[model samples]
Target: MGSKQSKDKRTKEQKQLTPEAVQVTHSNQGPRTRSRHLSLVLLGVVEVPPHVWELLELQRLNLSQNCLSTLPPALGQLEHIVVLNLSGNRLTCLPKEIGRLRNLKILFANMNALTAVPEELSLCGKLEVLSLSHNLLEELPVSLNDLAFLRKLNLGSNRIAHIPLCVFSMKCLDFLHVGSNRLENIAETIQYLQNLQILIVEYNNIHALPKTLCSVTALELLNVDHNCIQALPDDLYKLSRLRKIAMHPMDTGLHIIHNPLARPLPQMLDAGLDALFRYLKDKDGNIY
Candidate 1:
């Protein structure tokens, strides 16, 4: 009886931690900015209530963790919005009027049913962070590159087979995550994004990384875990800023454990970083 009770209690606790377990209403949803920042999260809202659009002063709107299947075109009325969170919903597409919010700087629409994003979204030129992970998107519109100021983009857990061509043109991008997709190889044009700091393309069909990847001198983290990679560039040391691979804050690092590595990489084992530094000196005729 005691063991059964404990198991039941643990299951109940786990359910409570998920977003769907908590029910809320628009008025009770807490907001850091009161009327200016309204968070209707975890609400069973099927549609934006007509009253929400009236809050024209809203600057940060969070409608995440809801049951919304479609957005009313009225979403464009909130021109003052700077941050918008629409994750954990059933949305198939966003209203084209989203472009009217020229001041928007951040948008999160992950864990949705979205098949595509409206091209007008590119009009939000000030956008700095955009996350659309776990969607059904196979490719993004070329207009995506118009967000010149975008610094972080997360497209993980999607069906993308190729890194969008627009991505290489984003000169200011610092963090790019395209893991858990169908990518068989990365484009050599990846070197064009000189400002890229993080490149994660794990759980794909990549056979070998391009030597030009070594030209990404600013990369600080490269995660190619669970891929078919057999060898890395002999000049990998050129990535002077690389600090770790698959080094997550939540767990101890798990780098290339599934890759059938070649030569020195396999021997590095317990001393991957140290071996990397030593290999650099041996090739460049300078000891580090």
Candidate 2:
């Protein structure tokens, strides 16, 4: 009888969970080995079963692509969870209980109906990646500054009118995506993200790129298509690592302001960043 219980425990620990399939311990049964990972995606999972909270040993949980409108507050009970994926759901707000996942490192709630994020989320001090793209968020709480390790932030396709001041403090940030929003300008404070590599602000109403933006020499990819940018900063060529620049294909009216008048943005983009850099280099106030 004890051998049979051991076999059942191994089976429960090794088997991949289906949407409706999970091994739960009965009240009459002794303790069972807790599962470390579970994925229950693409189902009408409006409510999570109470037994889920019993898995205190769970390290990763994938509840993506479900019809869940409400996340159970009991989620906080899974203190060992390091990755929580609630993407493609209908959740309008994350429960404050989420703060209990002190071990969490990655949180993805993209493609949701989230209008506001709970300040309690700031308690996840170890979070390195936070993706909340394709939501209705209009503003972010300044408390998020506590996530000192955050490396990537995806808030694209939201209704936010401006970049929050707290975002400028994320010193380790590598990628920032705020595309298809209502931003009018990027703060000069962006220069603080010295580790930044990619900056995407496409399809916004921005009229100009800040001259200070040229300080991010680590920038590799810059997308600003469909904005009203009429010129490039004279020092934009300082981003020596820039390999690609995405802009409105028809933005031929844009020009660079420097000695002897630099090339038009569209003309240089067509010529490639390499060619653009060469032009800027050769014309460094030495040539007419």
RMSD of each: 7.3, 8.8
Q: Candidate 1 lDDT, tens digit per residue, 1-288?
A: 999998997686555434443233344556543445677777566777677787777778888998999998899999988999999999999999999999899999999989999999999999999999999988898998899999999999999999999898889998899999999999999988889877888898999988888888888777888899887776777776765444563332335668888777777644776576577557667665
Worst 10 residues of 2 by lDDT: 252-261
Candidate 1 is scored at a TM of 0.83
lDDT by residue (1-288, candidate 2, tens digit) is 999998996576334443335444333444463445778776557776667787787778888998888887899999988989999999999999999999999999999999999999999999999999999999999999888999999999999899987788889999899988999999899899899887888788888889788899888777776677776676777887764443443232222222132236557667877667666656555342
Worst 10 residues of 1 by lDDT: 245-254
Residue pairs that clash (backbone atoms under 3 angstroms), model 1: none
Native-referenced Cα lDDT, model 1: 0.82
Among these predicted structures, which one has the highest lDDT?
A: 1
Candidate 2: give its CA RMSD in angstroms.
Answer: 8.8
TM-score of every candidate relative to the true structure = 0.83, 0.81
